[model samples]
Target: MRAIKFNILLILIILNFSAIAQIKVTSNTFYFGTIINIEKFAGKDYRYSLELKSTETDSLKKIVIQTRQVINKDKMLDANATKDSVKDTLWHQINVSNKINLKAKEMWLYATFEGNGNFFADNLKFEVKTEDGNWKEVPIKNADFEKHDKNPLKGFLTSAKIPDGTTISLQPRTDAVKGKALLIKSTKAAIIWKTNYGSNRRTGKYCNVNGIKIYYEIYGTGEPLLLLHGNGQSIVDFTKQIPTLAKHYQVIAVDSRAQGKSIDNKSNKLSYDIFAADMKVLLDSLHLKKVNILGWSDGGNTALIMAIKYPEYVGKLIVMGANLNPTENAVEKSMLNQLKKDFKMLQLKEDAESMQMARLLLMLSTEPNIKVEDLHKVNSKTLVLAGEKDVIKAEHTKLIASNIPQSELIIFKRETHMIPNENASLFNQTVLDFLNEADVKHP
Candidate 1:
């Protein structure tokens, strides 16, 4: 182990993996997430964090590296060697090649060791080179996926045993931003993490609902709450919302027929009404007469239909980004354009995923024809919601609310179609407020 100096332009970050050489770097510009230089070193495994301190004692902040990727593209033996020239190179740069946001203007970046992660720097010198990115200017595009000399990023790598609901992130940018971003690799080497609910993990038995095997999950113990995800999405979509809601209620999230873990044997053609009927049967199998329902996007359409057709099964209805009709007024112009673009992209590829996505998108163009009068028949207390910039038009969402007698409507400000994912806090609170405080009057 050799002793080294701490240097990063003007500001210095000193790390000590005892008996190992000091961590040194040539550049300080960080290149954000666009480039990650993982230099081979004669050092032990370490938890690293770059901390920024302010004049105030309580204002210190740090960015810790959560996920470390090791790529062996050519299956070279040198990569496995303990200490070799190629193995322990001066620096083997692994360019991130992904966009990472950096907010601080001028601050000291100090690399912290395990115990020293919380150390506050009093007056550490610092400098900003303003190198936003050089990787973006490179000739190669998506160098992570397609092998190219022009780009240095091999690809995203992850641990094999990432547990369920355990989101293995590269870094938690901010306290607020932590666990929000997920790395979905374009290629096969994706970060696959599932939520590990040891005792809570139960086998998803198939319910012969409408002859389609509807896969459902029941977590927690209380009043039943059926959670339905968006079009083409499965139970994974409700990953964030489930944990919180499950604590108070018996959360039943299902992988819709032909989506997620659910097998679809009943349909070649699909409609919201067809799906609504499936839900009614699933509830009957569980012997649940009435349950609270929350649905997003296409799931919302199904929920609306369920409440209208089988009012006995649904206690309260919460629908987001749902439309009564697949008309120009109901759907956004930009959404329609994006759908066309998606089809064009998938038309070139005949893969299962492409085919599946294309099929779902095609269904969005038609089906879901809930008449204005149909909403009046919905006996359950309904809460119609949509994002400010939702794929479904604002007028369309309000129209549903208007048609349903005594129903409430809410449009989340500055939010998109995936409000649950975008502004989860507000979305979750909105849901709990509606379901929990049923006795409280709405404004």
Candidate 2:
């Protein structure tokens, strides 16, 4: 019976694999596109065609079909649409032609609209012009929206945006040019990168701190809560936490020096102490005397240093996956070993980019030599957290927690260092609950 079930499962997998094709993109923005690998079609002429329909029928409006070919370092071919097509509700077949770059690795096909309205696309096709003058149909995965599953728009590459009245999905329509069509609707103008936390210019600002520029974004209104991301990461690492946390607190999400949009002097050696000092200067510049801080990984190490070295600036502290030292005893042996390997490789490369990365890796493997006795000096209420399978050893996390006068420790069962991203809701709520916990009553 087990053999029979296995056979059936294999057959289903084969069927699904062969039936893969098509994509749907839903956005309030004017454009949506998909990248196609055209390495085999290099130096060839090709035409891409698709059926388009829009609920908006203003005669002045048009839907432009465009193709762009990308090679190693440049866009070799670009074709723009000037025709005033897609002016009605009826399905209109549209096509655009372009020559693929001789060394092209990929091509982008896009549909751009001039005005706001509901949109539908179907019967997508791509053809390469043969040397003998024949148009050969290329196999496009699920070119028609015939699949009905949870992820119907699997092949379309679209960035995530806040659900601001825009939605895209596959729907069966009797009027569809084929079996089904992709429906895109919007009732509001699209705000690009609403959750693009780190790099969003609207919320981002920079300040000179200790000869380096630190980038940060502010959100919501209330008690200030500063968020610091792990090493080699940016403010975007807290993308899931910001929206929810911002509702209750003034979220001050910052990209640490040398990371994200923050710029650092290439000559300076990085350390958690340096990171902590950078935060101090930034907070001073913002005129925030005391604020709650939540940090992960290297950010967590910085948070610990802040609580120890500058207690006056901290109201509450939370740190996850932080260690007191860069040793096998503090971090899991495998990760420490891997860091050493990476650091060694980076040291051999003298290029500016390589040296910068090497410095970060070296710091990760050889610094943050915090003394356990220093933990006793932390005055702020603290929350020490780590995953059961975290790179930071469970014992080291307990050592840090036990030394602090008013501290709590939590070990997430069966979790790893990436719990912040893997189980963001739970992590966000945990941080909120800790920050919201009322102060202990005093006699």
Candidate 3:
């Protein structure tokens, strides 16, 4: 009986040790270490400082302290760290200071980590500059990371996983700079998160297309692949795809006419034809003759129109959740109804921004009148994709593929309209495979 008890105790100890292991994070994925709402700091000049120590410093590994401050509900300012800021076995202090725009309706502070390595963070400080050039502290709870528990992380709106190879232990550590520090260590594992997609200024540019300025960001070097986001979204929609896609192709992600950083002419009406025309003009300005296109939702509709109106500019095509027409036959009735409700609400406001929003909803409710027979005009190979549970009807997605001569169709089972954001790995790989396939011509 005593021997049996010892074996059971040994098993219990093993299980306990397993539970104490570090949280595993996937490699090449962006993670939000902490998020703090700072709306109260609006219009104030502030300084954010933190101390981090890296046991194994890596060039590819990154940790970013970013702030989201918006003006006119559009303009944004973000602060990022240099790749070399992190050092080995030494506590490094990082600091960022800027005036929080008064016009911003919402503001947030974020700490993000990515790549492979282990690090400890402590002594986070948020301070606002006074009129007399003095820095005053702003109260932030648990900034020292001393609280220890299963959910040891407190005071953060969202908590990120401890990196793959590191463990968050309640036991006091000998190497801690002060008290205990938060450990984020990762070997090579997959943990999904986001990147600074829509606001990357390094590769972003503006082009005059048909009188309106369009914003676009380009990355990598290979066959050009244009990415078009759905309605009410910006280049940020593909935050999950850009890093991976950029590795294999020259990704040209555009902020369609009126959304994201690109502003539209409030006087002009929105339509798929006009959007297609803008795309053609933008490509012409860039001197790109033929390019692969990937469009989601309204973007898909514009791409289809572009293929039909200017077939010469298209090399290959991929459309997800696209519809030939804005009718119940193509889109779900519930979605159309919601759009109608939103349009009605926006009409009541009757302001310039409201009018623009109403116009977008109007397009969603009644636009993209593509004829099914027109698919024959598209000469480039096409790939049609949708989720089984997408707001777009399954039959409509299939109809698009059947009409196009050289087209393929795929339906991700149990997925939704947001597959690009939710199932990025599979969605990106599928898109890459289609783009990478060599086209064979047969006489």
Candidate 4:
């Protein structure tokens, strides 16, 4: 009877240990849209940041946190058994220095505990305090124990494997102005010129299209002329040409879906087609029947899509430095090098979608497989123009001209991709001449 009782007690202890060995954490659901502060906290003042907490006292031998991005690795918190403040055999607080910058949005924290010569805390508590005075607490749920693990915050402790329950918190910066000035400045500079474009010039308006707010500006009168800019530029890029074009036509320029002041739609795929659709929506909003389209480089591709997909809406098409294939100029090594160099210098901030669009333009421009036959479907009266010194080769320009039945090809002498801005007078004359000829011939 005595032996049986001892055996039963041992069984009960084993079961209790098993239950405690598993760790659990409680916190809010992870949200992608939640704004995270990225500024470092001011002063050397340390806050009692609770890295992990538990309901029951348990001996903790090790604690760690892990993250993918290495933006602020030195500021993380890590503690070992010797560093913990122990009150009893089971309960303890792992104190960490308050000198860490917790401003990055994407990061994770982890903790590990050992008791009775065995690991117990497969989970740990993670907490963070933002400059906005908001506290967030998260628990590491299931940690991987087989792979090498280290404390993400302190970078001191290493584990062969980590079980779940990793917590990450991003602290906002105290000074919002200093931390985000560059981005703000860039955005401000992009739209500042539009303020002076006169009463007819419409300021940027945010409209919901397919549940996304698209920023757009409209100017001019008479026939609609939608101007799409090249990569890395906004609608303000056309300030030099707008006053000229708006004199004869109602000029509308968009910030695409991600560039300029437009807010990106997470659900929508970023493509030239989406851009064209957004323009279609804009036209629908304005009650315009059809418009003349002009695009440069990436915008040029977008104009092509508008002409091809919504043929009735495109009365005429004007594309400059447009290429049906990117590789056509690759044979000339010097031109290829210059193109790559120029492409690298173009700067667009918070414009990931535009970068993707630029890549597509490069690919399409170099595609040897694309032929004039493929462009036959473009029905709009087209004027394929390029600078004499533009990246596009003479043959490719001719091919584009040949594909569109009513299209004419004109090369500006001593000009490049940025022909309109470089020589505004010459560029204006060419466009005016083409429009005059088209009006007489078609009308």
Error of 3 at 73 (Å): 14
lDDT score of model 2? Answer: 0.75
lDDT of 2 at 409: 90
Task: Give one digit per residue, the lDDT tens place, for model 3 in 1-443.
Answer: 22222222222222222322133333543333333455676778977777776666565566766554544222344433333547467778777677877656544554555556666677778788877889888767777778855655565643323444555433344654447777766666454433456666556789987668899889888999999889877786786888899998899999988887889856677987888888898899889968999999999999999999999899899999999998899999988888877787778775676787777878878889999999999988999999999999999999999999999889888888988966787788888888888442211
Instruction: For model 4, give the 10-residue run with minimal summed lDDT.
Output: 180-189
TM-score of 4: 0.48
| Among all candidates shown, the one with the greatest lDDT | 2
> What would the per-residue lDDT of candidate 4 be over residues 259-354, giving only the tens digit for each residue?
666656363335677777888887888887568888887688778777777887888899887666557342235656755654453323246544
* Ranking of predictions according to lDDT: 2, 3, 1, 4
Say which prediction, candidate 3 or candidate 4, comes out ahead on TM-score.
3
Per-candidate Cα lDDT values, in order, are 0.56, 0.75, 0.73, 0.52
Instruction: For model 2, name the residue pairs that clash.
Output: 21-141, 21-142, 22-141, 22-142
Per-residue error (Å), model 2, residue 385: 3.5
Q: Which stretches of candidate 4 lie over 4 Å from their true place?
A: 1-202, 265-269, 329-371, 438-443
Collision count for each candidate, in order: 5, 4, 7, 29
